[model samples]
Target: MSHSKHSSLSHDRHPLNFQDTYICPICRHGHIESLTLMDVFACDFCRHIFTANLKDQSIHVENSSQPMTWRWTGRNWQAANQLDVDLTVVIWLVSVSLVILPPSLIWLSSHAFPPLVGSSGSWFPAFWVGLTFTLHFLFVSWLMAEHYQFPLYVSTKVRLRRLLDRR
Candidate 1:
């Protein structure tokens, strides 16, 4: 039900028929066949259940944490709600914020509420800035790794071991 976008192909599609064997859009390996005497379809390989909308020629994955939907195109299935989130734009925005925000915040805070003359300690701002930069950098790195299919997210223990071995 969460799947909103219904991206259909230019070619026309036929409605679901139990006689035909449609490939499972979710697993991409199984055939989606209707369960005997049931309205829902089940994938043989992935065992994922799907509910069909014959009117729209769409099948929705059932009991999934994040609902996924696909439309039958009379040949292959296409994602119904694939957003194609661009990591490049996301990375760029995060990088820009990483370079700009911390320093700007420090400068604005200093001017907005002038620090006490004697109580001023530069270390606090420095620490805050460092923490902010580190967090942003880690997030961007993870996003990049995922986009590029890098092995950086292999395992926490492996990463810790690699970190310790660096010394």
Candidate 2:
């Protein structure tokens, strides 16, 4: 015959109960605490609300009562429905170029490549300036679309494709 002794810790542990020491899955900056409502937990630092499922031992942040469409990637929460783009450096370069390029071109054309006054060359400078301005505007528009993830209209995309195909 064998006798087994039950541990007090084992008796106190409930499968559905969450400890205050558990780190928040979303922020990782705060401890998770059980809310007044059942199976709900909240982060102290980030103030993010989560629902705890004890049966599966899973923590889920609610986008709604429905199943979540986002996932925590250890560092941040990402939309599972959206494709991620690695455009950090491209966005930064475009932003800096937008701020610096136009002014630099204007200054260079006015001072370094100034047109002769009261001559046919005067119209040349105006044309050059107009061309530079148009190019700058187009470049900025393209950069803005890329930065904001703007969807190109179908007709515009088809037109651009046709134009490119001609070359």
Query: Clashes per prediction?
Result: 0, 0
Q: What's each prediction's TM-score?
A: 0.45, 0.34
Residue 164 lDDT, candidate 1, scale 0-100? 92
lDDT of each: 0.65, 0.54
CA lDDT, candidate 1, residue 151: 27
In the range 1-167, model 1's lDDT, one tens digit per residue, is 11111212223454566545676776565567788998888876566788888888888888656567888777678778664469557767877787678767876775677656667684566666667767767876775554442223423434576589799
**Residue pairs with clashing backbones, model 1:** none
Best by TM-score: 1
Lowest-sum lDDT 10-residue window in model 1:
1-10
Index of the highest-lDDT prediction: 1
The residue ranges of model 2 lying beyond 4 angstroms of the native Cα positions read 1-93, 96-103, 152-167
